[model samples]
Target: MSDSGPTIVLLGAGHAHLGVIDDWLKHGSPPVRTILVEPRDAMQYSGMVPGWMAGEYRDEETRIALAPLVREARIDWRRCRAVGLDPVSREVLLETGERIAFDVCSIAIGGAGRAENLVGRDPRLIDIRPIDGFIERWSEAEDTAPPRRIAVIGGGAGGVELAFGARNSTSQPDVLLIAGEHGLIPGHPAAARRVVERELESQKITVLTGEAQLDDDGALTVGDKAIEPFDAILAAVGSGAPSWPRESGLPVDEDGFIRVGPTQQVEGLPHILAAGDVARRTDVRVRHSGVHAVYAGPVLATNLRRLIAGRSDLATYSPFGKDFYLFNTCRGTSILSYGAFGLKARWLRRLKDWLDRRWIARFSGR
Candidate 1:
């Protein structure tokens, strides 16, 4: 790094930003100094996370140590949550009472779960949202009896994966997937949905679709009738950007996600860029899949370099026209979806396990 005074402050270690950090280190860093400000020392790879829940892998297997990467890149690691930003002053104020000055900045603080929105919730009720927090909850729950009645409130891949993982790992918690929508994985191919539906049925996991709500008694209600009582509720629904971005005065979309150009730079703020789940592209609403985040890394890195070199920051980020989605459903069988195509087999599961191990290995330095 040059002895230049300018600095680039990255707010969170989101998936794409981690790849960007790796690329910038593997190649060469810009003259501007780099600093990563995240609340956690390790970043959990969301892809292998389901395996951890299934008891097939440990928590350590899902996380990558960010300290080494930050050191190798000669970047400072600020352990704190960003509360707000002063664009005119070009400084970020953290919740820990420290202010970081930067010539350029990027935000990737990630999404949050609104468990507080639930009515009459137990303070200890597990909300499997953040990796670190969820790991702790899972550990504690493991020591106790397996949850007698568990409701996973979402129909997305995450919810499905978690439901199967719980069933595989525990004494069958009377698992039920409550999807408010018409079906699980609404926009996914019908073939893929059918496969998942069949798997859920085979596992004896209940599927509640159309209309459902989690009442105070931990009961999932469907159209004025209480279906069942749950010992715990794990929500994978209503995921959105952290409240900080909108509160920080950045230009965010109606859903509170930051809007970015193809170059990954914030729409109005040239010096501030965003990627990962928090970023939304106006032209193409890419499925917030890890693949897109992985693919956006190089582009974000190149544009960051260009911005530092007094050149135009222009890099194209194209969404995958045909996303190849691979997920393991706890019974050691894998599901694959590419565009409208679908496939499932034990061999596919092994392949997915290998792929996840390799991907995590890159970051974990195993």
Candidate 2:
């Protein structure tokens, strides 16, 4: 391979991988060329997405401008979607027929909502997964006229936050959360779930729990109980990566998650690396949350550079064994929890907002 060849090809703009790109620019470029293959011009912060939906944060406030970052990094920004990979050739093929060559490649494309599998999969139903699609769909929902009965599927953090945000965003519309499991915030503590449930109830947003399914006509039902019809449906359900990885012959888990070693390198292929939601760290069976993506960035950057320099790989990635939660409450109250521990107050919300804003500012070169 020539020195001018692509140094590392980053496949996704997920949390940690973007940080790696930032760090690479801060220090210096590696010997090889760097290329970022993503479909969007900006990456949204998943942490502040709830705030954006809630009318507390603006769209621009939550995004990192990819154009500026690409210019500053002096890396090739292929504004295209990565369809699949040839791990043997170290080539990434885009949906647009563009092929990028790389000495090292990383996959961070993340996942999408299982929209098609849901019943009543109407064109009006919105899956708030990838940030780009969410913004566009939410804009449409806002434009839709009065008496908007919106349904949010899934009971996880994203679902509850989105439910709160949607309810807070409108006055005339009815916001409903359809939790597939027993309660809102399934894995969260009892107190946290109660708080969210109480808030949704106080705001007049209906909360339903059961095996809810949507039909093709946008109707939602929970266990033979025909729920109120929804003008807009937002599915915040869990996601898996694009099927391209599994088809590409790369090793993936049963859930379609890419398996990687601790160094963020794809297992069985040293030349390939992965981070963010797509990469499943073998040692730690952590949930596919954005927190892992945040920590994987530096390690990936360092190890990628070291691999280029022929240096040894560093330690593996590990998650803190505590359950951490911070509620970006729509009521201007941020509730924070550490494992079984919990804290709630107005000042906490302000502090959390300040921190989120500061992080966004950094990405914009502030």
Candidate 3:
């Protein structure tokens, strides 16, 4: 290492970067001068966000204090969004027009919820990926009179969870879930899907399966049929890659997600690395979930440290074939799924709560 160590910049305070901060706290900081760039001082743990929405936990329970972690790790914290990156000059341009250079950079900004295309320019659309904003809107909605009907777009786990959360949080009994043609959680086993479908029925939520779009007046149109006007629209659809990566001239997938090899290093750009939803592994098809991001964190940290210290022996990320997923129904029960098998019970809900709390405790320094 040189007299002044390499400047390592962490682009986002997502799950993977949280793991990096945890590692640094435990093993002592790396030799390099580390910097963390994120607009928010705290990051909400997505796993417990449904619980918060369902009134099972307080709002503060879902947040992890990022400022404390950055302070403890001796990292320079920038409370701003990165608007652009100049790879040729190795500088990250901030929204405030400040250019910060880095010898090595890791992008973990997560994915962007493309609400514009789904809602057709609707003015009253709320997306769930950026949990902070969603939580704020949810609070405002809760404070006001409950809507007669609310529509949740997307059939994946996020959509299902949000539908249940909204049901638990509101006095309105009419919650509708609109999914794609494959139905709820199409990638999961049939049994798992059945559990969610049955719960939706039991909760009195209507399920609409097909492509859907919002009309100019904010009405949901599903395959030539226009449904009743929804008072509120919650979008839990899967996220798309942010624009910065593609505009940065980095190698990215069709969706604009940065492409990485097995080592989590951006293809054709060894100095730049990425993980979490913002990154796609070229070797294998990985789902964009918190599970994959949290698991990839340690490997990312190790590889970055090695590269900084002039070590050729770097670690590679091997994605899991089958991972355990817990879905909180927000109705006093939860569902656990692994491969083709699934289980739903109150005990599983307790387990999910414990696991989520423990994970958050790590970063919260509790």
Per-model lDDT: 0.78, 0.77, 0.85
Candidate 3 lDDT by residue in tens digits, 1-366: 213557888999999989888888888888889988899978988888778877899988888988778888899999999988877778899999998888888999999978776667675578986778888887887788666688888899899998888888757547889987878987887778888888889989999998778876667788889987777888988888899888879899898999998889999888889999899999988888898899888888898898788787889877766467888999888987788877789999999989898998888753
TM-score of each: 0.93, 0.93, 0.96
State which candidate has the highest lDDT: 3
Which of the two candidates, 1 or 3, achieves a greater lDDT against the reference? Answer: 3
Model 2 earns a TM-score of 0.93
Q: What is the lDDT of residue 80 in candidate 1?
A: 82
| Model 1: CA > 4 A from native | 1-4, 118-120, 123-125, 216-218
lDDT of 2: 0.77
Tens-digit per-residue lDDT, 1-366, candidate 1: 223587888888888888778887788678678888898988888888777777788878888898888888888888888898887788899989888888888777767765546423654456656656877787787778677778777788777887887777756677888776656877788889888889889989989875655566755577688866566777766456778778878888998888998778888899899887788887777766677788887788887788877788478888757377776887888988777877789998999899888878877662
Candidate 2 error regions (>4 Å): 216-218, 321-323
* Number of the predicted model whose TM-score against the real structure is largest: 3
lDDT tens digits, residue span 167-207, model 2: 77755468888888666777667777666766677778888
Full ranking by lDDT:
3, 1, 2
Candidate 2 positional error at 5, Å:
3.3
lDDT for 20 (candidate 1): 77
